[model samples]
Target: MRTSKTFSIQFWMDTKKSKKSEGLIYARINVDQKRLSISLKRKLAIKQWDSKNQKHLGASQTAKEFNRYLDLSKSKLFRCYQELRDNGEEVTSKAIKNLFLNEESNGYTLHELINYHSIKIENTHAIGSIRNFKVTEGYIARFLKKKRIDDISLSKLNFEFLCDFENFLNAYYPKGHPKAMSHNTVTKHIQRLRKIVTLAYNLEWIKDDPFRRWKSTFDKVDREFLSDSELARLATHHFKIDRLDRVRDLFVFSSYTGIAFVDIRNLTNQNVWIGDDNGNKWITTTRQKTNCKVKIPLLFRAEKILNKYDGHPVTEISETLLPKITNEKANLYLKEIAAEVGIQKNLTFHMARHTFATTVALSNGMPIETVSKILGHTKITTTQIYARVMDHKIKSDMDAVQKRLNEKARKFEEESELKNLREKIVEAEKTKYANLTKEQLIEKLNEVLNEKSDTN
Candidate 1:
């Protein structure tokens, strides 16, 4: 059975809740015998409220303005009800009240949405991802505070607001910081914001997409890696300090295997196994950041280093494959190692993986596809970033072309010399035949044929 829908708005003063001579004004909504109430955020004396007419009672200017406001509010509430009914939505007093309050029933403020999204993904997302979202939420809150806004309705979010937020992010600095964020850092923050906005839009909390027309661009940065010579120096150089020696060994291991620090830290004996091909040892592990499987054939030097630390106390106690150290200390020790080795590039544990991808694999004619798999890259494009075009690779490519060109030139020269010799012999024979008559030429041809037959 179909039920009739009814909605009506009325203004009244709550005399029972009045603590002083003035009572607070309230709007009461009624739909199909159900009721919902909301404060109108105004106050009037009990004597001024007209119970029968549902309006202010005086003819003064203040009373006239208050009555006009109340009339407008009532009309807007009725329009809200009519629109909801026309749109085939359930016409309830509460729905009409929400519309009148300018708050979408399913909407959330920006910060609230961010927090909600963060909580939703707290367990499923990686720690780095969760931290980034948290930082992004803080940035958004600061931006809103700077604008002196307590909260913004999702419906009020538009392209202009996004632009203003982006501008704020570009100019934002942490406390005691002298410079604003870098270009890529700002891009990252905006990306997180876009994700939250997209979630809201997908959930139908917002009608319009604020980021539809905006394009995010990040600056390309040149990642640093060690050259072959520098890598060799680090590999062969003997450090007097035992701590530096251990760090060097770990870095060299990464340079050979292309495994990242976190994955290496989590490695154990079980991860190393004999490959079916060639019966050589291989490191099979999953990347910590992307969770992509990486299988790398252990190089001679890498195998040697592993064997060297076979019975170390730290490795045994930690139940890890290698001597483990904190990432902070590893990087700090790498700096000292860089200085000791007389290398200019800043040494980080991650750069070891880059060196393995470029210097050890690509420059030595290893296929990019194989390099990408060894490095645990989900995309070849990501591997390409580490495989910068090296000077030696360029030289080797050009040298192969030069060698082919030289061989072609030499063959052409030999063919030209043979052609010139044949032309000279024909000219000499023709000159000798010119001095004789036709009979003499016939005789000479017969004689030459006889001489050739005799020689055969």
Candidate 2:
């Protein structure tokens, strides 16, 4: 039997149950997206095994001797593989593992790890985030089917598997989506895969990080937000459809308060607060995405919307601060709202947060730190992303400086021209008199001095 180029041999430790000092080493044989593992029956100190170099770390006698044993085991495995091939026997990881271990098998499968991870994180993560992972799982299942693969052993999932998955995502045009997945969108799927693989590595189910050499690249996206005029129009415009009005009000509330759609959906009256002075109103909640605490002073417009829906049927029934609706439908109605208001940008519920950052807050000179706090961002850099997209802010910042510079430069040029003109006029007076008698020169000089300046 012939061996495939995808075949590889690696040594890793069973560190999950090991004491801090040492761990038992195992050999993994990989071929064609499958893996078979067998213990090398050697224990090495945790610090001695350099995972990256796949060998011992230092030049000491013990390290040298241990690495020599690892090298000898590798050569023995290679000999077994060569013997199998020369004998015209089937060459597979399982076949080689059987010869090496002379016994039973134990390895984590891809789906097994995913199922474990899913069950493990089901309680901690948000439903939307869990659902998104499930959607990625579906894509993975589809990819495996397309490649005629039943399942991959987690230890055998290499860089090439990720590359194929990325290619699949790039070409995937699911129903109702406008086009194939975008660059950043494709990166997102692989990102999910990386998370899963990283979890397995951390759990000691795998030895080396399959993604060690892989790097994900993302394209910068220009997010859309409403202009002041469009926002005002959308805020004030009355829609004939009642559902459109509710969606618009919620969107406008988010635009005013900068709350995310999921967090907005989960708001309640308890989230609203009044100052001890009993004058100021506020909305306080934890961000669903970041789990960071948020406290926003309610603006007049946002408070009005809240009051308008107070004790209303939908809010009362749903036990929320406002009418409840799916994000899908809210975004759908936002399209209608955009067309009614004559705005050209493709609107999404998240853009309301962008509008708050760019048009409402940053454009109006609100400090980014305050905006970052109100938005429940853990890092100031996260808020800076919204700040970076404010083209209007950029234009306004440069406007006065550019205008002042241009005016000063023009004034200097005029002064220089005026000085040159005066010098030329004096020269002309001197030359005109040089060709004349003394009396004519004096008369011409007097006449020229008396004449009004035509340069004016």
**Residue pairs of candidate 2 with colliding backbone atoms:** none
* Candidate 1 structure lDDT: 0.86
For each candidate, what TM-score against the reference?
0.73, 0.69
Colliding residue pairs in candidate 1: none
Candidate 1 per-residue lDDT over residues 139-204, each given as its tens digit? 888888998987777777888888898899888787878998888988898898899889887876
lDDT of each: 0.86, 0.85
Determine the C-alpha RMSD for candidate 1 after optimal superposition of all C-alphas: 15.1
lDDT, candidate 1, at 195: 91
Please give, for residues 324-369, the per-residue lDDT of candidate 2 as tens digits: 9999999999898888878898999999999999889988989999
Question: Which 10 consecutive residues of model 2 have the lowest summed lDDT?
Answer: 98-107
